[model samples]
Target: MSTPAAPALDSLDLALLQALADHPRVGDLELSRLLSVARATVQGRLRRLGEAGVIRGWSPELSAAAAGFDVAAFVSLEIAQGALDTVRDELLAIPGVVEAFVTTGTSDVLCRIAAASHAGLQGVLLDLNRSTSVVRSTSVMVLSTLIEPRLLPLLATTAAGREARAPAYR
Candidate 1:
């Protein structure tokens, strides 16, 4: 069966999420004060959001470049038929591989890798090319990041839409 749809977020839920996003380290009391909601409401909403898988984690985001991995590249792999699981397992063993996805069209798998130097990047490429499951591969180095990863803007837009649809009395 297909998965059930996630419950829709009201304006208050959106506001709470925005508050948390802005101040990830802020406590429930502060959040309640900022949103003009009860502390219990903040706690209950956070609990519910966490339970629903909306709030995945509170971990700090790390920068690969700051950690000595200065070079980044996107590698697309064409794997042997029925070898996706095997390839996935093998990729997990590679330290430089940050993210990977099974995709459509020309490539079967797409991976983002980080390395300390061009030589290190070459070594990682050699490792991928050595894999028996990988039939072909293509890659491109990232020159610069134009936009940093973000979610607050999208959340704000969602909140605005929800508010616009609400009845005047509420």
Candidate 2:
């Protein structure tokens, strides 16, 4: 079955999201006080957002680097014709393959991998190359990340009717 559309967020909803983003661990009572709304309102809005899939999870974000996976790379995979499902299953079996996307362009599958060292990365690459469904693979090591993953700016822009400029990163 197709998923239903997410509810359109209003100004108050945006404000509540921003407040929650700023203080993820704060209690609903505290959030109500900060947003100048009743506890019930906060609870209701949060419930709606969660039900609509706007809030996917409450887990703390973890860093691969801080977790001792010091090396990272983006691997572009050219897979055998109509082998996406098989290749995806193979990719998922490898722990070092952190993220993957099926794309439209020169390559079919794009993967972000994390490893403890260059040797470890090479081992992961070798494992990828062993997959029969993968026709070819190319990769580039990440020297540094200019911008970490962010969603608040896009949320703010949507909330402001796409008129507000995103703030400069510190």
Candidate 3:
């Protein structure tokens, strides 16, 4: 069973998250040393955070280009009414369609997909269209990424909020 969700993260919780973000390769022992806390403390904190779903397992970030799937696009899909589930299942069967979401717009579903080339993308689109559930689709290819994914700054801000409420003695 999943553990109960955690409430607002405390200062220490934020500190550990920040430390891990800065030094992803560091072990718990090194983390405790850097933070000047007991090793078991670090271990326990990580365990609790993980069990509470605050800490998701770390997975290496791989570049789509490095994997030879260079072309990336956000494809908005207009799904046939009453076929959302069928279209979603169809999308899942296609490896090129990486992420999909139900959206509020002209389209019913939005997808982020990668292909080796424009021709490959066309094949992906064609494959998607094979499912009659997918009525139509519009794709916007990514020109470039100005900012990579990051959440540390926002986490820091959350920690600051907790700090503001901390007891003076703490």
Candidate 4:
């Protein structure tokens, strides 16, 4: 069953979310202690947050280097008009193609792909070119990644803004 939808997040909700993200392995009991809330409150918020799609249940993180697919690259492709879905389907069929996006600018779509080596990447690129709708592609190899995915800082800023707006209660 789904929890009733929340129009927007309150500061307390953000606090609970931040606390959970900071300690992913912690249970509701521990969360309550960490956030200074009742255990039941933590449980309720988690349930609501999950149902609201605020928390997509945890997924295991994978490293391409550890998996032996070290080569990483982003490819921009120009596709025939009205054929994005078809080309996307073809790109998804390639095992090396990890993710894709439709974006603005010179190219119609962009994709992130990985390979075991330079030769493997060449094979993947050739496969990408075989799509009937894809007319051209430009690939850029990733030298290194400096920043990884993150969200805590944004949550903190939003939560602080909400707190500042709250009036002193009677």
Instruction: Give me the candidate number with maximum lDDT.
Output: 2
Q: Count the clashes in each prediction.
A: 0, 0, 0, 0
lDDT of 3 by residue, 68-92 (tens): 9999989999988899889878998
Root-mean-square deviation of every model: 1.9, 5.4, 2.3, 3.2
**Cα TM-score per model:** 0.90, 0.90, 0.87, 0.85
Better of 1 and 4 by TM-score: 1
- Give the C-alpha miss distance for residue 83 in model 4, angstroms: 0.7
**Candidate 1 residue spans exceeding 4 A from truth:** 1-4
Which is the better candidate, 2 or 3, if ranked by lDDT? 2
Q: Candidate 2 on 52-76: residue-level lDDT in tens?
A: 9999889998899999998999999
What lDDT score goes with residue 90 in model 3? 92
lDDT at position 143, candidate 3: 87
Which tens-of-lDDT digit does each residue in 28-52 have in candidate 1? 9999999999999999998887877
**Tens-digit lDDT track for model 4 on 81-156?**
9998899789879999998999999998999989999999999999999988998999999998888877657766
Candidate 2 structure lDDT: 0.91
Show where candidate 2 strays beyond 4 Å: 162-170
Q: Residue 63 of candidate 2: its Cα lDDT?
A: 95
In model 3, where is the ten-residue run with the lowest total lDDT?
1-10
At residue 90, what lDDT does model 1 achieve? 90
As a TM-score, model 1 comes out at 0.90
Local error of candidate 2 at residue 58 (angstroms): 0.9
